[model samples]
Target: MRPIRRLLVANRGEIAIRVFRTARRMGLETVAVFSEADAAAPHVMAADVAVGVGPAPVRESYLRPERILAAAKASGADAIHPGYGFLSENADFAEAVVAAGLIWVGPPPAAIRAMGLKDAAKALMQAAGVPVTPGYLGESQDAADLAREAGRIGFPVLIKAVAGGGGKGMRLVEEAAAFDAALASCRREAASSFGDDRVILETYVARPRHIEVQVFADSHGDAVHLFERDCSLQRRHQKVIEEAPAPGMDPATRAAVTEAAVRAAKAVAYEGAGTIEFIADASEGLRPDRIWFMEMNTRLQVEHPVTEAVTGLDLVEWQLRIAMGEPLPLAQAEIQLSGHAVEARLYAENPAAGFLPSTGPLNHLRLPKGVRVDSGVAEGGDVSPFYDPMIAKLIGHAETREAAIAAMAEACEGVEVWPVRTNAAFLANCLKAPDFIAGDIDTGFIARRLDALAAPRAPSAVALSAAAEAAVALAQDGDGPWGGGLAGFRVNGAADPAVRLFLDGKAMLGSPNGMSERSVLADADGHIVVFEGGEAIAFTQAAPGGLDESSGDGAIRSPMPGKVTAVAVEAGDVVEKGQLLMVLEAMKMEHSLTAPISGVVEAVLVSEGGQTTEGAVLARIVPT
Candidate 1:
């Protein structure tokens, strides 16, 4: 294969941006393919040439192999790089690219097809002497047959779709009564998601730690493994936090797992970068022989940066070289790892509000310095409801795992995402959790601690005080309506100006100058409030307090920006608190918004398909 001159990225978002950076560093021209929604995305702007492939949905854009290939040909691209999601792991896409005389910057079509289906991959692993999870992979699609098989395997079996990922088309059957429903649901989801209802049953191994090994191969039959990553911190079977050099892995276990990963890659005659995932029972310390092969990702993974951090190797560089017919640059013995790294996926969602996806114009978007942020959107970019809501990947590297965790937590705290809801604070809490810090993690870690993780920690009094101080500062800058400073001051005023401020769902009393003391004076209209803390008031009133205080109950608002797909309720509709009221489609997922309190709907401020920014009122409910 000729050296890649122009590479077409058949994906969008941060991964596309990431691949472009690597390609540029390798002196390769980059071609970006965007959907209608992503025409103005950062990834498109970063590329040497941008091509519009199709409409907003992924099926029309990224998943249309013909469109991607056409764009590559139009852009004069010699290679196609499928970054992570979309059609990244599609074997058909790989075959088409190879047939079109363009280099595929990933594994061969054979390897991809072999590992495309979870059940097929498991069978291959079992034949290759790789330990496989014990379950039913038989070709019986009858729900009754599956339920019987599940009973034979015992209770607590996991029914997973054979053709998809991201926790879709999967169900856990806890008991016989729930088996049929679970199986039916799993099949329906499978059909909907992957267009295939075929599923396999696996005996659920409780408390298993999710780990995966990154393996790379070249065209010349050379391959190497790059340790493993701990992806146990997950919710809904989707990874939230990932780290390299799995926290409690011993040397022997690491070597064994790495060897197994290398064997798995070599078995497929794999080329380019791939990951062999495994589930390990961490109830016992990671043992050399206890890990079972899960599945192989035939393309680059979202959490690849953690692997990059420890190995000190640019995996994308190797992918480029291998695509150009170069042999692996290093042998198994030559590869070395250092330092631990952690990555937190910063999503445009509110953790306190059921992780509902938020969408809107991002205002005051300031990413943390001294931390690596791989993002596809900018400060003013809208987090479209048509794509993934992940704002950025926050990565931190340090000499030790503990240090790395600390750094990641600090970085998350330092990040300031304004006007959009995000899970930054939740991520910080996860990093600081005792279980996470102690390295006691499992796939259920996040779910088990969901309550604690979702509990909103009230901002400290000091922080509120600081906000008050800031208000005072803003008022004193002559920006307030009381420009002459006499607005807050009253000649022997009888009552204090009772300005009300709502923060974290609680109302607080403060004066115009940011003073919260009871001795503050107020006008008869209560529109102007004086804050007295026995100290000088700092800020003046900007507008009448009634206008600001009129906003209803302190419901947790949408955190990210998004559009309302369906308003489930109407004004005056009585809803049980926490009942689904609407569906907000953001970042490609439908988030069901529930009522915050049991009440009659006061107003339905937003309708279906209405665009909403963070803090925009969708609906209000009054006490029943």
Candidate 2:
């Protein structure tokens, strides 16, 4: 076994920091490589040695293998760890690391290539007797052939990109009539996203749940499963929350499924950290026979913290050890699961704004203190559009699933981020969902209630009061009676001098509460922001007459800085309420703007392919 004296992480954000944490604990020096945008990131600061990779664009920086390799050499890092994204799963990169004589803290490149593609992975799994979903894996890229296979598999089939992941390049065709168009669309997206248009046809599950097993292997021919995590709480196929020891999973079902995962890993001669994802048909609850292989992630997963919480194991440490040619730490019988653990991902996005990426300076950020928080950005840092907008991961562990859920929700509620919005409120709402709280959930849980969950709420009286009080405290001296106690609480006068405030242009009169349960802050822009119930309410002091500033008219504006991709109508065209007006692409995700009222298109201010700033009017409409 070779010892790794120094380790370099070829990624940034929480992933790099997480690996560095374990590496430091193991008495290894840690090196960090960062892009220009992340030069001042926490990971860089946490490293013993930091190297500049390249510019802010991933192509110029993180994704460039040569730059990372050079950094490793210069930093004298004897080992390299691709922390979960960027080049983490790239087989070529892994091979390159090994070729350069540095230890690669991951699965073998052959294993990665074997399981990188879904169709190929399924074929291999089938050979190894691992259960895979019923599908077509024939080497046929022709549309007609795919449609024929779909018909054979029967209607309500899934046309999924063989190279796709993260919900891209996937379509559910409930009937044969929609198969052709969906296939074409799926192929286009697949080609654009993954550079491969080949797809596979699978029979659709009436109800599906996402469950993945954390597996670890070593070079010494030993492997074991670290139980399972239910990541069914997804939106757009992106996991929002994850929990270990899947809820409603019986011991029998768990054994069968986890054993299959381990078998699949061993079949590839896998090593280090990897996740075997499965799609369970939840119609009859989680059953061994009903679970089928989806795909395998050949690197550490984002939800690894949840598994670590319950398993009481440092997975990264295991990865490092296995990479150093060690055997599995414990046999299957000795590995044990303790308590239930739940994790919520707090992302820099606005749930009410259709979950659009909210990129800006954090300004005021406060994660909950009680939970185990693995954060990417700090209070003074910025959430750039160049990378993933996940601000932090909050993990909660307890004796029971119910207690873990409650603890996770409470932690989410305590999260306070301002200016740049977050999905904390939506996460809390999801935790409170009756079906979710009861462990009755599926992959479509978020989509089924998106409208209600994403709807913007009115500021509460208590929130407004606390915000105005915070504003008063910042605007005036602290010796006044208003600053001494509750601003609007009158000891011996009429309660007529309440503060006037504008919550995003909604005029309101509120009594400032100097002492309140919720967190309140007055920003540098002289605006009052209240944090409570996992939502941030920003209030501006009302102008003389509460001047109308909102685009409540017919102006369709871009929610964030982005490039306009499409315009559906010309000036003067009659449009119905809720009709698609234009499409904006920001942070690599598209946001469709629609008409607010039945109106005539007054003007199209932004052309397709043109860059626009946040809140910029893209199109204007005049009500009929």
Candidate 3:
């Protein structure tokens, strides 16, 4: 280990800010590397010094280890912390950092490689006596071979890319017929994301609980576990909610899993922060024998905050200390677990619209006040398509899981983001769900109830009345209630002033009343966006006798900046309503664009392999 005086965080967004917080506290100067798209990001301002790596695209920016190393050299940084996503697990990057004589604030290159690939990691875990999921890790990449293996294992098997993480290169195939297509999509995503299309098959745990134990080791060869986290709440295999001290984990089960996790970590000579992920058969109610190892995350996890909340430990501080050749702060016996904590990932996406990414300027942003918030963007910041759409992480801590859930629910309901959609209401619903409250959950819990959970929320009548009152107060051309501008207005005697307002374009009456807090905001254009129940409902005042209106046109435009992967329809092709026209890959996920109405394709404005910016028309469907 080398002395690290100046640290450069080779990443962006909240993770970079998070690392900078610890580095600053430790009396180390922090440096940040940003892309052109992130030139104005808060993370850059959080650091003592910042450097520009390249343009917006990750290929030219964050993914280029050489550029990061160059930034470190230019900034006189003696250490590099590859914060979670871009190249956190890239063995080559770790090696290069060492070769450049900079301390790598991560695991050793050998450890990263040993657990980077799903197949190889599972093999290594099995060899170390860790229980692994019954599946296939055969070396052959033939489609036929994998399909045969899937049949032998059974239907409803999981197809996972060998190098996949963050649910990018994985698919759940429920039947034999869908296997081929799922395999192809998985492979395409795998190649695009990890540069490796090789996949592995796993027996799908119908009622699965995603359990991972946080492990830390040091240069002195001492290791310990920070208990475990339940990351079972997920959508499309991506974790949405995480909690520490997994619900229903008995004492025996905890001991078994923790010991197994330590064994896995010691096998790789793991140091710093790592997580040993496991999949449990929740159908049997979280028995020790039913749990099996899935894979090991070689670097810090996005859900590390929950672990920190429970154990009162700063994992990043431990990483820095370990990298500085220090011993483990405490042995396993000395480490203690405290209160329960829950974390909900707030994303800039529309849950009702198939969870498509929503990109725009955050005209109004208000995170919950009572909980821990890890945010990278501010009130006027833009949520662009150049990176992950996660806006903030809200964590709630309490003495019990139920209390934590309640706090988390209230926090989620207090979120207020306008112009851009969010899944805040959806998260609140999950927190308050009867099943979730009872601790009866699994990995497929969100997927099974996605439709009902994502049902669009409408402002209540009381909310309308509140908005109307605020709008009237703001309309007086003055501030607050009972201003001199409202001198001519009657307060109580007559029928309350009935003002026509459009709630999301639907004409409604804002029952006039007194003014309230700033919970309801009126934009410069006099359009008021009401924040209630985690929903941001826009209300624009209608003219004396008219109302405002909006509609979707027949043009199919890219939702955000992305690469055109497949063009399903061409010019002159007659397509029906909701026909798939094109597929765009953005932020490591594929989005399918469909025809709005039955029509003939007038022209295809973009072709396969072309990069497009937000709102660029890919095709025009002239309604027939």
Candidate 4:
């Protein structure tokens, strides 16, 4: 095989950008293929040349083999890199690339096929004497048949999509009564996600730590494992925090798991980069006997940075070399892990609103200065509702696991973006949590702490003061004193002149000029109001628009962009203080907007599917 001079990246987002950076360093020109929605994405901008593939949908763009091949041909690229996801694991696509005279910078098509189907892969592992999870992989698709099999396997079983990854088609049946329903839902989601409804049932283990070994292979049948990553911190089956040299893993168990991973990769004559995932029970310390094969990721994972940080080697470069027929550069004994690393996926989502996907134009993007940020979008780039809501991957490296965690937490707090709600603060909280700090994490970690995690905390006094200062600055800009001066003079001078001041959905009525002084009088909540030292207070009034005084802070709005999918009620709708008001769908997920107080909806500003920019009004409610 000839060395690659040019490569086409058949993916998008951070992975695409990551591969291109490595390819450039290796003196290889990179070609990026993007959908219509990603034309202005950072990955496209970073590539030496970019080709338009199709529309925003995955089927038409990133998943279309024909379009990818066409782009490769147009760019004169000799190899194609299938970054994880979309068509990355499609054996047919890999075969097609090879058949079209292009080097596939991934495992051979046969290897992909060997590990693509969960049932077949499990059988293969069992045959090789590798640990396999006890489960049912029968050929029956009948719900009753699956249910019966689940009953045989025991009460708690996992219904997993055999043909996909990213936790898209998975369900856990905790009871016999819920087996059929869970199975049907799993099948439907699997069919929708991977076009294959074939699912396998597995005995679900409680408190399992998700561990995976990164393996590299070459054309000469040489392979080695690169330790393991603990990725148990997940939400909705998707990984959130990933770390290297899994804590609490003993050397004996680590050796066994890593060896098994190497065997699994070599069994399929795997070449290039691959990952063998394992599920190990953490009820006891990690042991070789307690671990079982879960699945193999046939391409570079999103959390590859953690692996790279500890090894001080670029996996992508190795992939390119292996694809060019190079032998493994080092044996398993020579590979060394020097330090610990952790990676957090920064997403455009609202943590206080059930972690729903957020979409909007990025008004400000400031990543932490000292850490590594792998991202595909930039400031002013649109976090579209059409794709994944991930904004960036923040990775921190340190000499120890604890230090890495601390560094990651600090980095998250330092990174900031405007107009789109994010889970940065939540991530910081998680890192600081004693359970997480002690590495006691699992798939159920987030779910069990959902209420505490999503609880809205009041803004700090400093933050409130800053916001007040900003409000005052805006007021003093000579923008026009429509309502008069600090003396509380009103333009209409009526008993009550209502001027709209958007304050976290609450209405504040006062002389427009009342905003100028450090202290002013206003009406808040049918009472006398006073504003002092950047705070507002409320009291009772004799009339409907009575004069009052108070001091208080402001409200919190949506940080990012998205579409309002549901409005819980209409005007005059009496809602509880925390009742769900609307659902916003962005980046293909739904987020619930809740009521701030027990109030009547005075106005519904946005409807389902209505496009909303950052700070766009969704509704207004008058407190009861």
lDDT string for model 3 (1-624, tens) is 467899999999999999999999999999999999999899999999999999999999999999999999999999999999889999999999999999999999999999999999999998999999999999999999999999999989999999999988899999999999889889988898899999999999889999999999997888999999999999998999999989999999999999999999999998889999999999979898999999998889999999999999999999999999989988999889899999999999988778888888887888888899999998788998889999999999999999999999999998888788999999999999999989999989998898889998877776677667766667664655422112123234333677778865578886766433336666666566667778777777764333211134577877778889888898999999888898899867988787878989999999899999976878888888
- Candidate 4 residue lDDT tens string, 254-312: 99999999999988889999999999988886888899999999999999999999999
lDDT by residue (tens digit), candidate 1, 388-450: 889999999999989999988887876555456678878988999998999989998888889
Who is ahead in TM-score, 2 or 4?
2
Per-candidate Cα lDDT values, in order, are 0.78, 0.86, 0.88, 0.77
Q: Which whole-number lDDT from 0 to 100 does residue 86 have in model 4?
A: 83
Tell me, by TM-score, which candidate is best.
3
Full candidate order by lDDT, most accurate first: 3, 2, 1, 4
CA RMSD of all predictions: 7.3, 3.6, 3.4, 9.2
Task: Give the winner by TM-score: 1 or 2.
Answer: 2
| Higher-ranked by TM-score: 1 or 4 | 1
State every prediction's TM-score relative to the real structure. 0.83, 0.90, 0.94, 0.81
Global lDDT for candidate 1? 0.78
lDDT of 2 by residue, 1-624 (tens): 999999999999999999999999999999999998998999999999999999987879999999999999999999999988788889999999999999999999999999999999999999999999998999988888888899999989998888877677788898989899789767766765567899998889888999999999999888899999999998877899899989999999999999999999999999999999999999999998999999999999999999999989999999999999989888989889999999999999988767889999987787887789998788889998778889999999999999999999999988888788999989998988889989999998999999877776787877766765665655665434321223233222233357888865568987754444566666666566777788888787855353243545877777888767667798989999888888776665556788888989989998877888887878888888
lDDT of 2 at 616: 86
Candidate 2 has an lDDT of 0.86
